[model samples]
Target: MIHEISAVAFRQNLGEMLNQVQYRHDSILIKKDGKPVAALIDARLFERIRRMPARFDALCHRIETAYAAVPEAEGLAEIDAAVAETRAGR
Candidate 1:
């Protein structure tokens, strides 16, 4: 669940805020003059997000198709010649 706290209050109770985040998986929105300025989120939450699998295979297929539409270079001979030149340092 999300909670809101003033920036001053958050500063005063920073330890408690961090403890709450680690134990409860709660998110805190820090407000300045009643407007939200920042968010405090637990590291574990980001870990979980990173571990979750992507849900849309169609999205991946679309991206691959778009990438494959790009034209290939005209000749590998030019690339090989450049590589040989680089290896010779000439």
Candidate 2:
């Protein structure tokens, strides 16, 4: 479950919040001035989240290299067709 708490309340109960996240797999969203500012999540989930950018970069690089010889118009057309096909449930 996710808990939305203000910055002040989060600061005042940091330890309790940490325990909730550690033991119950609960996520805490911290807000400042009534707007969400940050979140506290389990360390393992955080690790996976941290790796996403690197993984995305690697995937982008691989696709770019594979498509380097394709013309821009053809590449765009292929992407459009693929998107349309998927959206059309095929």
Candidate 3:
């Protein structure tokens, strides 16, 4: 379960709080004046989210189609030119 702690308490007991987070892998919801202000989560959890695949390929395809409507180059020549320029540092 997630742990809730007041901002003041968190500031006063940071070391102990970090120890709890390290051992328990529990997220901390920091509150200010009885309202949630922020959260402290483990780094591994953030990495897991970063590695996960996108869930909306259909949405991405629709957006790509809409973007393509703007009408740019018709072939790979433009892309190849850009890549060559980048490789030459220019």
Predicted model with the maximum lDDT: 2
lDDT of 3 by residue, 34-54 (tens): 999988888898677666655
Tell me the TM-score of each prediction against the true structure.
Answer: 0.55, 0.85, 0.55
Clashes of each: 0, 0, 0
Q: Look at candidate 1 and give me any clashing residue pairs.
A: none
Would you list the C-alpha lDDT of every candidate in the order shown?
A: 0.84, 0.98, 0.82
Candidate 2: count the clashes: 0
lDDT (10s digit) by residue, model 2, range 11-80: 9999999999999999999999999999999999999999999999999999999999999999999999
lDDT of 3 at 90: 56
lDDT of 2 at 51: 100
Tell me the lDDT of model 1 at 52: 61
Compose the digit string of candidate 1's lDDT tens values, residues 1-90. 888999999999999999888899899999999999998998987777666655355677786687675545634565788999999996
Model 3 residue pairs with clashes = none
